[model samples]
Target chain A: EDKVVQSPLSLVVHEGDTVTLNCSYEVTNFRSLLWYKQEKKAPTFLFMLTSSGIEKKSGRLSSILDKKELFSILNITATQTGDSAIYLCAVELFDNNAGNMLTFGGGTRLMVKP
Target chain B: DAGVTQSPTHLIKTRGQHVTLRCSPISGHKSVSWYQQVLGQGPQFIFQYYEKEERGRGNFPDRFSARQFPNYSSELNVNALLLGDSALYLCASSFGAAGVYNSPLHFGNGTRLTVT
Candidate 1:
């Protein structure tokens, strides 16, 4: 079955500590990988990585995908209390008859203590 | 502009019952997708509708069904609801059915369904 697995299911770090979240996937019809941050409500989009080696970054959050390795990593630097949330990784794949869809990992819940 | 909107933010139902959740996508977005997110897990795709057509569906059973209106708004209905059906039902909108390639989905806060 097509699936994505994320490591360090949960973590607690004091402010200013850097953390890295990992995700590995196995699926057919690979297209892209996306990262999201979920706080209390719905998830908000973070980064979408298509090609390998090229890193996508925004402020203190950055991500890169290694297609050959079938994995992706999300890094958060100089973390603040606001950074606490569930970091989710999702793989987008083309479905022959169903167009495209996303298979998501279990997510990494990070708590940034201030 | 307002983000995706879902109605009946919180719902309570019992086993074997039926319930319907509603969603209004962002203006101009033509595609809407549904997801089921249980506690401590990521959201799982349930269905995708565009132009009132079913474009994709996940591993959910027939008990789960959804339809999109001409305005691009959608509704999700669950029949013979089981306890396992309790979850946060999320609605996301994008420009088209193929947006999974590039478009980032704008998600609504979601409806919390409690099955007892």
Candidate 2:
């Protein structure tokens, strides 16, 4: 079975603080890793990482994947109150018979205080 | 353009009852997927449909069935619901087939089902 695990299930940080979330996966035929932020009901897309070493960034948020190590990390340079949400990590896998599917981690709940 | 849209933001059911959830994919999107998310847990993949064909399915039981229409809309039906079936059901859509690289899914707000 494909599995994705996230570390530090929950975190509390203040404004301007930087935080890093970790995700590791064990699967066959790795296709890509994606990050999302859920505030209320829907989860918004953040980044999709496919290659190792190269980091994908958007404003204060950034992520990097290490295929060899089977892990990825999402970094928030300066957090704000609005940044409080559940951070989700999902791994996409492709199988010749099963086609493609995504498996998600439990997610890390982040509470950013103003 | 509207994103993925699901019907009945909330629902209440009892054991042995049947429920049908509806989803309309984004305009021009050809792929739609369904997921179930329990409180405090990650969403679990239930089914994926593209071009009106079943592409992939998770480990859910036969009681959980789904079908896609020619317009790319989809419906998920669960029969004989149990207490454990209560969860948030999410619908996601993508422009291309799920296997396509770099394709990200756009999710709907989700339907919260509470089985009493």
**What are the chain B TM-scores of all models?**
0.96, 0.97
Q: Over the stretch B1-116, how does candidate 2's per-residue lDDT look in tens digits?
A: 88899998999999999999999999999999999999999999899998999998888989999999999999999999999999999999998865357688889999999999
- Candidate 2, residues A24-105, lDDT tens digits: the string is 9999989999999999998889998888999999999999999999999999988999999999999988755446878899
TM-score on alpha carbons, each prediction: 0.97, 0.98
DockQ of every model listed?
0.67, 0.68
lDDT of 1 by residue, B66-96 (tens): 9999999999999999999999999999986
Q: Which stretches of candidate 2 lie over 4 Å from their true place?
A: A96-98
Q: i-RMS values of the candidates, in order? A: 1.7, 1.6
Candidate 2, CAPRI quality class derived from DockQ: medium
Per-residue lDDT over A1-114 for candidate 1, one digit per residue giving the tens place of the 0 to 100 score: 889999999999999999999999999989889998999988999998999999989999999999999999999999999999999998888776556788889999999898
